[model samples]
Target: MCGSTVERFFRGISEFIFHTKLGVADVQLVDYVSDLMLRFVRVDSLYSLRQSDGMRTKHVVQMISEAERRIGLAKREVYRHVGDFTLFWSGMYPESLSAKKNRGESPDQLIDYCRQGKRAYAIAAEIEGGADRPSSELIHRMSEHFEMCAYGLREVRRHWEEDDDSNGLLTW
Candidate 1:
């Protein structure tokens, strides 16, 4: 896709980790996850889903409720956003969730991120009518392999932490 240097950086690391270390050779999945990482690097992108009052939706339940109120591609995209949201947090920074829980700040304390993520992806994959089969199939595969992808993301975080040159790269 000839993205920016930052995107390329994420793609390179994601490819090496997901394909080589994690044995997930699906190029589409790797690309999707890499792009997701790239997108979520920004605080605004991480919480891009907004309410009618223009407030960012912080909780997954609220996101799901909003998704249910939509129709067509918009609904599908919101569901997909939910999946991405859950995966990004649960995979990349699970320890933060624990910390939040201990401090009584975990908004999703009673919710299961993995189950909701997989279900959201499945719902997203089922939407639309063959207008974009490739994306639908990719999202479907994401649902089927959600756990592996989440594990792969955890490994990605570990690999990045072990690398000394990755400092401040994701800040941009």
Candidate 2:
């Protein structure tokens, strides 16, 4: 059942890429997201193994931990780029990037917001930690969120490509 679900998720992602106007930046983001998905699938599979054969559950746990580390790194990288671009596109200097316009707050004050996003990603990565009694609802929600991110990236790339084409800009 789990294997089939994973396969279906990958198929959906591929179909989305084929039907959407994916661009270089979007493709890059998709690659990162895809890597994360693959890692999750691996962790899930290992977890399933633990249920039928408890002998190697420890190994599965270790694998999940490693996958979590990788996911965390990827999340950090994504946020770093996203934050930089957010500041640039908004015409805000680095010092003012996190400032709250209405509240007159500094970027430091928004650290919790960033942490919340990263925590979501971290939780997704560790979704299989309790495989023996994993929450199916949570897994489904994570999968949906992953797909949404992929689709959003594709749309962003499509718009960027269109903008470049209209201006005769050589993105290559």
TM-score leader: 1
User: Over 4 Å off in model 1, which ranges?
Assistant: 129-134, 165-172
lDDT of 2 by residue, 37-102 (tens): 444445443233222333333222232333344544443333322322232222212234334444
lDDT of 2 at 85: 26
Listed in order, each prediction's TM-score against the native is: 0.89, 0.24
Worst 10 residues of 2 by lDDT: 83-92
Per-residue C-alpha lDDT of model 1 across residues 77-96, encoded as one tens digit per residue: 99999999999988999887
- Please give the CA lDDT of all the candidate structures: 0.88, 0.39
